[model samples]
Target chain A: MARPFVPTRMEEPITANHREARPSGAVDTRVEGVVANWFPRFLANGLDYLDVTRILDAIENWDQWGTTWEAAGENYEKLGRDALAAGHSETAGSHLRRAALTYQFAQFVMTGDTEARRRIHLRMADTYRTAAPLLQPPATPVRVPWRGIDLVGYLRTLSDDSPLVVLIPGLESTKEQFSTFEPFLLERGLSTLSFEGPGQGETWYEHGFRDEAYVDAMRALFAWIVDRPDLSGRRVALLGTSFGGYLALKSAPGLPVEAVVDIAGFFDLKDFDNLQPVIRDNFAHFMKIEPAEIEDVVSQVDLLGTLPLDVPVLAVHGEVDPIVPVEHAHRIAAAQMNATVWLYPDGTHSCNNLHTIVRPAISDWLADRLAVGA
Target chain B: MARPFVPTRMEEPITANHREARPSGAVDTRVEGVVANWFPRFLANGLDYLDVTRILDAIENWDQWGTTWEAAGENYEKLGRDALAAGHSETAGSHLRRAALTYQFAQFVMTGDTEARRRIHLRMADTYRTAAPLLQPPATPVRVPWRGIDLVGYLRTLSDDSPLVVLIPGLESTKEQFSTFEPFLLERGLSTLSFEGPGQGETWYEHGFRDEAYVDAMRALFAWIVDRPDLSGRRVALLGTSFGGYLALKSAPGLPVEAVVDIAGFFDLKDFDNLQPVIRDNFAHFMKIEPAEIEDVVSQVDLLGTLPLDVPVLAVHGEVDPIVPVEHAHRIAAAQMNATVWLYPDGTHSCNNLHTIVRPAISDWLADRLAVGA
Candidate 1:
């Protein structure tokens, strides 16, 4: 999402202890604006409106945004811990799970200081892992070796024979954000594998986002899925949002994917110089490289080179998506041998504004493609 | 509940066919204000924030509130029906269940015309029953004969031996609103019986709220549970909110209830003249009685005469509750032989504002009392 008008990346992440030397009004206004627009996205993605409302209300100081959210997350974490002490496993699981996602958002786009962001990200992962076993369908942590590091995933199955839906989070999103969407597929008897590729969530500290490395990670991941006796025979679908959508298509050509649901995916990459500075800066932050290197990375993230994927694909996009243009969806559908585009005319990024209808519809579409029930 | 507000009851409920003669601006503003305050309650009781936001945003005409919500409910119902036709049972069940609650809220305070409110209420009941069998641990629609009519409740059990928690809704709430709270108990090896006594939901039009009838309904409900061989020997907890809390305490004395949770229960009924007209009118509307009779009705709905019960009681209230004061919790606790006052200093009516913590905590407290797992 290349949206404009708020939260420019700073040279250093604002820590709990000090105020960054930036103009407070400008930073606060922009951040508040971003927060205002993301209400629909946050609610659709599983952040309780109450939680979102309270945290946003409490974080009047934009410099302390991360640490403020971190404190609120710790409150939930303590509540979860108390529930666990009382032997209320489900309550513990739900609260701790909420804490994980809270911590995830606490660090989201705080790329001003990657070190601080990574530390918070690691805590999110730990909280998630702690909640994993207590979930209704317990999560199975997945680790595939890549670039001398592990590409991380959390798999949750509904039943032994359930089909698989591999979910990929967006540029700033992580595996934890799939908590809301996972239910739509899970309720349809489809298991889910929510993963973090290179330069995402867990491994971002060590492994940077590289075009070739992303493809390699997917390659390794697919192979690992095949090797698992439990997941071998099941049909599979790939679903990714934003940047993940671009990568899903970029990687699907040579992979064993049966279907793909790409939300706001990219068909052609914009020139780094022509793109918004905020976009370029975020890319640089995510890539762990300089802004100039972003051009090379974008050059490799295009779908043109990997044309004509035979797998069924559903391109879901928002016509008014603040970031990627809706033209990308059209371009993507046009290039695919079998594809359809479901674009919401007045939707924001991810059609999150239309989530009430779109989420179930996409899960239903995936269920149809995989012949899940039948 | 007794706060000052805008909405004054109309002589007739607004109909889809024609607009009633009402001041649009005043009506709309007041209704909007009420909606503004109900966010935590709505989310806490299972309304998706997106749905609530969209519906509230769309309803500029306060006169059309019922019809507008009714239309939204139908849309979800159609979606649920389509999912069912496509064999997505779980998705269908969830959507339909949502539709039921949507329809329930559609008529929550639309007491302008008892006939119209009853019609929408029936639709909610039908939709809920349709979705019930598709639900996990499928809800059993219970009908016990009373006053020459069948009393209503929906029972869902985790297992053959799971302890039962009987959930009673607030003054304007129905059995369907229990959808959100049921999960806490269900997730903790407890069964739930969501009931609508004499003047609650489906039967409100037929049997008015008489103090004797209210007590008799609980007696009949407890007896019906005893007769079920499937639920034999299981522990039972009674939980009621707002007016339901008053009813629960007012009726628990001679019943076979092992535990009771009274959230925002009234310690003493204020004089009808002293109560806010909105609250008085709403109570009158719910009771289907003349406002003049409210004083006599309030006289009979107190816990003073029936106290000193040996059952474990939890009086959960807010220190600054808008309706029943925190003193209610203290008074209830004082009257009961074994009781605890969980008074949140800043909680709203029914402690709905603190639901995320209060709801699970109450369920966990009940679990501990019932010896649910050991």
Candidate 2:
């Protein structure tokens, strides 16, 4: 008989920011923070109901949270393998997707044990790679040549003639989450290519996060897109969510993109002190510097009056957003010569509270701008 | 210039049940009872964010909640029509679907007003019929001949040779909600046909809710399915949600089906008193009786040694289901000689809490049982 599934992570030591205690300068109240951080995933089918239940059950104390998620992920991954062996590709895809989500959540908000975090991250990427091919239409893996390294991406297409839209994920987010957003664009006849650039996903291990790394990497990705014979688009739009939104706007002036979509993205680093501890720490880790040094690094980041005037822009932001304030949206929109701004009064970070409206609207805008299928 | 949209409903009188005060025995504690009741609709894209926000802003003390949704719905329907005129079929479909959702919510819990409810219901059905054909794969409207009347359904097909699974919606739910569930089955080569039978959708106006109407309608639907040349399948399966779970299992023995999938359905009416007021009221409205008479009507509902022994079964239920008790799953499973029961410990009504796991598992089970792709 197979041995019982057991996660092999060493014990984490006690720290000042225990799960029970509220971290200093937390963006939201504990309950809201917990729900807001994970509820979107549940809505996106990134996390299963059972996983949410387990997390909710251990709401007050979360010392075992990482280990619990890791074990569940491993078990789901095993199930996926078993289903694949049985020639049930659909079932395997479902299980593996869930496994990837679980693995991603295993390290969510966890800042300890770099080796363990890396192990889980690798497992997530591997699981996603294996499962993406089994999905309907299938996601073809891409390796764009970078400086002495390679940026990884997944190209999901309905046809070779379809227009391309490059997706940029934000801090602490991976391309795996784009499964939720891909279908909307695909249905509109726009193929999507989402990748992990410098300081994002697996590439983060090689190149530490810099505020400018995102735009630089996007430029390299655009270069790669220009050369790909399989991809059919002379000019592509860049869509960035959260912090990636900044990258999309920043790169628009430099790249051969027809349009740019920035959703709940930051325009200035002036509000660095206002961010939640978790986000601040994650950004600092990506910058390979202490939290204190983050302000100085971010001070150099700004998009006021820097965006290309020719590029049509769609910017969506929530007034009540805790991470990137609503002012960032105003700044970006003001700087752009041609821009459409959608401000949600009761929206959270990323305008997630208004996803049903914004997602379709964004897709419509992209399709219209790209003249996809025309 | 295009004429501005205007709703035709007159002003409503103040009622005992306002937005702030919960009707006796209401479940949720929020001031916005109506919004809380259907917030998930917005989350699922059944309703638009702007519409929902409009409703919430005017929700301090609603005297015309039904009219509010109806006006919002009419505005969206107008938008849909305008989009269609502009040669944007995809946009038209989305708008129409959202319009249908808004119209559905208009009369969701308005049991006291029958004429308004029927009018809104007709609008919902009409909009869905128009939008269904615009969707990818397209929904072909099917009218199965019933006793002196025609039962309405939408046949969503991927291929002519794919297996068929008929979907049954529960109280206050419609085929529109199945948009989320159908893709899973279709991915595994099983076409879906979601319909309104007896006390549901368009059929409800013709034949008011009768305890036996669901089974009777299913019988008629099966007969039609067997004869349709456009659809191919020797035998079909029935999958039902909420109250329809009872209908699916109850009709399984008599219908010419190969399998049944019951998600969070009731086994017996013994626990009728434990239900929430809104659900009980809706049931009463469907039955064309008073809330006090519902228990007597439901008392006739039970399944003991009634399910077929030959057909395989899949039953999913939430342990903490607010509407149907977990014991119903136990009783239903016990009665069936071959049954698989998945009871979620911390699940809500319909095990919606466990949708990621339950949806895929049910799809796999149905595919395996009917040999859909084989």
| Best model per DockQ | 2
Each prediction's TM-score against the native?
0.91, 0.82
Please write out the lDDT profile of model 2 over residues B319-353, one tens digit for every residue: 76766777788777767745777776655677564
Give the per-residue lDDT digits (tens) of candidate 2, residues A1-374: 22232221212111112345535454335445656664654444345433554554444435565676777678778878878887779989988987887788776656666777888888999998899999776888888877778888898887767778889888777888787788778878888998887778888888876656666777788888878777645448889998889878877776888888998898888878777876787787667677677777888678866764478888888777877888888777666745777787666688665565567668888988988768
Docking quality class, candidate 1? incorrect
**A-chain TM-score per prediction?**
0.90, 0.87
Task: Note the DockQ of each predicted structure.
Answer: 0.15, 0.17
lDDT of 1 by residue, A189-303 (tens): 7899999998787767778788888888898998998999998888888999988888888888778778988988778776456655445666777788876666777777778
What's model 1's lDDT at B260? 88
Kindly report which residue pairs in candidate 2 clash with one another: A209-A286
Off by over 4 Å in 1: A1-27, A271-277, B1-29
Fnat of all models, as shown = 0.14, 0.13
